[model samples]
Target: MELSFKGMTALVTGAAGGIGRATVGVLAGQGSRVWALDRVGLEQEGVEVLTGDLRGGVLLEEAIARAGRVDVAVLNAGICRPAELEQTTAANWDETIAVNLSAVFHHLQRLAGVMKKQRGGSIVITASTNSFDGEAGLIAYNASKAGLLGIVHTAANELGPYGVRVNAVCPGLIETPLTREAFDRPEVIQPYFAALPLGRGGQPEEVARAIAFLASDWASYVTGATLFVDGGQMAAKFGTWTEEKAEFAGGRWRLKPEP
Candidate 1:
């Protein structure tokens, strides 16, 4: 009924907002000495909170130094603003990749150094459902999240030898304060709900629990896996009679109801 991570040291990115804040609260409540790292304001009692962009320089260095050692590092920082493929300019794509992909790498590199010195740690990255399911307008978001799978896999293979485990959590539509307004919009959530098999989005804490599991001793042997927390979005089937293109007996295909 209770999960304990007492005395552990954790660095959580994107801690000023939604899922990150939820994770910080969950971990802190469970006894982990949490460093709530973010690029914006975050005030919490009994937590060594720091505000800074994880991209580069003094901010990251100072945070790591302050922590002394990190037993868990979560790269939960990412950005997504819906932009169509053709309409997605170079700047748009670059920003998404920078924050969602490049930022993860930056944090990983720094934290891995600290963890390796301490001889071990767990690294959880926040990927998204869009990584696997195609979202028409958010092309850059899709690519950035999908890239985390590769990063986790490669890191697991490389870091496993050092007792460091790397994994990713691909969250579905989570109902966070930031999404509350957008999802509350009839012009938005109405149509979105139709596609959600559960007919509702998930909460940030729901995803946070999964991250904790992966980062805890219970998952000591788990690594290089993408755990989807979507509301069956990845498995939802088209109403019926969807077409499938395949190389059958002689490189031909047919349109039929999938068995």
Candidate 2:
């Protein structure tokens, strides 16, 4: 089936950055009237750009009010402060939740009001693989992402009858501005290559495509689902057994016949 957003109106948050910027491009290219929201401004053909902080919620509400109707809402603004559980301060936790989970809730609450009355819409959130797996020094980030699942499932069930679908895209090791510096370091990037079954990092457009599909009529029957755009990272938990067998030296299960 051809995926098209012809004549649709899509509001995308965090549009200045990696995944969000790509999503704005995808939606616009697909013929949607796009509103790109971020702290920084963006300029592109067929897209209306808005700048504001997601934490305050005023900008989001204003955008919705101004648009009058929203066909698709992509909640992609989030922050990650790497602090271990014990080291995680209250401020750290609050900021992460405010931008990631709470902002999503507020946006959806507003969008649902419009969509329910209009009787149809799609909402896609940019969750993360960290939603399922815990990483050291990312307590708040992981928790907030995990919380998005609850919002997705509950919102889906409540809005399903109204033809409003809510879903999330969980990205893993995507090449984005946020990850560029770390990805540039071989010490940081090599481990992921070994763990991911696809043996490579994903691009923003890859995740954006999934988000676009979920936000389109193509996923009409799909709801409360979390799609992983992780290059098989989530499915490659046991990959180390084969890819790094040399680490098992002196064990019965060596890479070659025991001598």
Candidate 3:
């Protein structure tokens, strides 16, 4: 593969996981001095692992100090829980938003300050296919991801003039620790795996490559876009009438997706 970031610097949040780790490895391989920030222990050779919470002010500062200048910021660190709407509590909602959406805002607030002076930068947020289609038991995950796109669009437009590009990558059922348990759960992901058109889940590196391209100057004109990396899952058709949320020309309140 070609090295697109030989002299650039990158900051990858959640570098201990699948997408983040793959990103860290790929960027570092391409000669970018990477600060792989995560809350978990990452024993990688080329990475400078900063283990801390992204929502914590101090850790963010420390990571920036270590990175010196952030040219590419890939906000890939996020958590999810399968709590139904009724079981979702205020605390869970707040934490989910904090880690997923608020933390992205926090990172952007700081990165904008740095990049504004540096004159330009790139930001890639790891959103989810959940943003496109709703899941019954993952209200918090779904809502927070949807909020991430709002941030992406607003930031892209607001920061476009500054030469900074902001975009979102929505991955569908990628292979990661986050989805491992669910996929392994005989009661859950196994049965639904067939519902996916590709007949298999995607690897984390697949998502990482797309994010790498978006963060590079190769995508100089790409911003404010949400790229769906699912294997045709979003196009699934759902059956007959479900209760509508609002009256539309299609006689449906919301979209009915099939698998």
Q: Which is the leading candidate under TM-score? A: 2
* Candidate 2 TM-score versus the reference: 0.91
* Cα RMSD to the true fold for all candidates: 8.5, 5.0, 8.0
| Candidate 1 pairs with clashing backbones | none
lDDT, residue 227, candidate 2? 99
Q: What are the runs in model 2 whose C-alpha is more than 4 Å off?
A: 240-259
**What lDDT score is found at residue 177 in candidate 3?**
91
Per-structure clash totals for the candidates: 0, 0, 6
User: What count of clashes does model 1 give?
Assistant: 0
> How does model 2 fare in lDDT?
0.87
Candidate 2's residue-wise lDDT over 1-259, tens digit each? 7899998889999999999999999999999999889998888887888898977778887888788789999999887888989999999999999999998998889889999999999999999999999889999999999999999999999999999999999999888888888777766766656676666678999999999999998898899999999978888856643533433322112344454
Model 3, stretches more than 4 Å misplaced? 1-3, 238-259
The models' CA-based lDDT, in order, is: 0.81, 0.87, 0.82
TM-score of each: 0.87, 0.91, 0.87
lDDT, candidate 1, 15-43, per-residue tens: 88889999998888888999888889788
For model 2, what is the error of residue 22's alpha carbon versus the real structure, in angstroms, after optimal superposition?
A: 0.3
> Model 2 clash pairs?
none
Which scores greater on lDDT, model 2 or model 3? 2
The predicted structure with the larger TM-score, 1 or 2, is 2
